[model samples]
Target: MGQHEKVATSLADAVGEEIGASLAPVDAELERLYPGDPGTRQPVHTVYVPGDAFAADTVRSWGDRALDALDAHAPDAASFAAVLGLADDLAEPVYARVRAKLEREPVEDLRVDFEDGYGPRPDDEEDQAAARAARLLAEASARGTAPPYSGIRMKCMEAPVRARGIRTLDVFLTGLLASGGLPDGLVLTLPKVTYAEQVTAMARLLEAFERTHGLRPGRLGFEIQIETSQAILAADGTATVARMIQAAEGRATGLHYGTFDYSACLGVSAAHQASDHPAADHAKAVMQVAAAGTGVRVCDGSTNVLPVGPAAQVHAAWRLHYGLTRRALARAYYQGWDMHPGHLPTRYAAVFAFYREGFAQASARLARYANRAGGDVMDEPATAKALSGYLLRGLDCGALDTGEVARLTGLTRADLESFAVPRRGDLTASSG
Candidate 1:
């Protein structure tokens, strides 16, 4: 038999053996779990970085700084208005330096930090903390100064836990989503994701919130933070992560890399020196590999230490170098985080640089492959292999577009149907 026939037969036989006498039911389950044809095209290379603090003061200051920097360096009206009203002080020299950087750089994504305590907390401060977070979100929304694509990290995990009870997380997220008046494309960041159950619990809560608010079911989406050791060290770590992604199903937008938390879990010192250490890199690499072809964007955690020294020259040099490193990661198909307004220009610079390079390379390679296969070729076997590669690459670069991929690859739309693998739960009914 030919290779393709042999492979298909083997797979079929394996399934039959695994299910024993229930071949039909097993086939049905397999079909549900691995539905669709083989050649789906999805965009993969979008970048998302977190904004350090989204409180009124921080956002306002950030905006002002962005505007002043833009005015001095680029002097463009759009940039000026977009970044204006950040803070009270103009800091002309700082603005001038930032403007210089913006003149040449472009930003694609911005994540605004809503709540994360830096250090130390009292047991009695839970209620106050929640109220404080609520007020901050409210002010940020009302002020209209937050970034266009902002996100919020709720107070999900804190010592002495303020938002208590069984539905505490649900209540906290609901309050933030409802009373906070979040931006339209806002992403909710879930920190310390340990188990698939956590993701499912959160998903159910989101569904309930949508129903209560009269909003569409999938209107709210979340990005999981895989920072805990339990997440990385689980016996079925990869499977668990995949299950978490599948649990979110259509509601998860991306996966975030939490370096510090992850390091702490591994008993590594949570210090600046540990930001991109070998262990962190290996952990992030595993996450990236797991997220491939899943249509879920993955981002690297932020640098914990900020630049210090002669404000203008030192910050500028530090930022420029930092941007370069971020650019490298982006080029490798991993987006990262930025914690401050001053870091915005660098974030965008990295994004645009990475995309410019990625798109050019991908477009050229795809064109070459198309030519080699001959125009409009639709070899199912060949197409499946190529499409798998394309899906992984596209997801890596955030360039997945079904229509565009179909047209370019010369694959029938039907072939793209199998891109999303169905959940194992969806395929089987448990007797218990």
Candidate 2:
């Protein structure tokens, strides 16, 4: 028995050293790039308009028009409320809140699209459009009508259009910078990136723009469109998103999904290209995983169900758009593309309802977990983090004010403000 006990053991105990020391640099990198909380404000939806159609008051005008259309189409907030599955009594109040938000901050983000929205144009016409867009952007900034997040989307840098895309972007940026420099929250959108080299090239171009405009090194970040199958899945089935990010060299601020293009690449017909399609989900999931912890925001694609035509048609379209937007919100993809002015109201409505409906239960669950009440309910750390995030999102999107969030969550303004980064031991405690 003594001899058996004295037998050699292959297991070894960990030495007295810092296990995370070697990972210090890696952790620092991940934190620097994608901190537990990215303090940037993400809009509910980004309204995309043709480049030539952009104007200083586009967002405000769109909001006003959307409100009128909503009023006329629904005849009462309750009419649309029925569509949203909200209570009849709550409809007017919700509608008022959404209307106010739209008026005050009608567009949180705007993409002056030059790709699909603008389509092909003569070289001269394109340049003129770019210049006009630049002038309007400056006017919007001066008039304080520019959305918090505003930028332009250039054509894809692919063959037969690479030179044209770069020219349009250059012309636009040159004119924009001439007015001063990149406006606050400005970001360019690069479409159809099939390889990492495309992102690297765009980064270099952005760096040049910064230098030429006498702006900061990272002032000109861009959002890449994950449209083509090649962008989401390589020939060998390896994800191309991480490679794209690495190539961007920290200039990739966002990744936007393009439903139709991605679906077309998957051989899906026009009828099948939809925001909630499995193919779109697969592309966005790849985007989420690759861009996670990298500070690159992921945006869901737009719904093609535009609210137009007769009243019944508009209602039908609104219902579809509302459903798609809600689906995106439930997936934690807050930002999306809004194709028309009518989508503005529905966008805000869905976001507000999402918060309002979940507020009470989320707050109670969070408080209960924090207080260790253990009322047969439990939440993981990720759940707690997400709960806080929902509130933060509400506050950022103007759905909830500081006072409201404080009262609802029983957290101070400061605590709610730093909800992005929570204390490890106490989930309610913020580490701002």
After TM-score superposition, what is the CA distance of residue 108 in candidate 1 from its true location, in Å?
Answer: 5.5
Please, what are the lDDT tens digits per residue for candidate 1 over residues 211-247?
9877876888888888876665567535466677777
Q: In model 1, which runs have C-alpha deviations exceeding 4 angstroms?
A: 1-60, 63-115, 118-146, 157-183, 235-239, 270-275, 311-331, 357-432
Identify the candidate with maximal TM-score. 2
> How well does each candidate superpose onto the true structure, as a TM-score?
0.58, 0.89
Candidate 1 accuracy as TM-score: 0.58
**Clashing residue pairs in candidate 2, if any?**
none
- For lDDT, the strongest prediction is 2
What is the per-residue lDDT of model 2 for residues 355-374, given as tens digits with 9 covering 90 to 100? 87787787777666556677
Model 2 earns a TM-score of 0.89
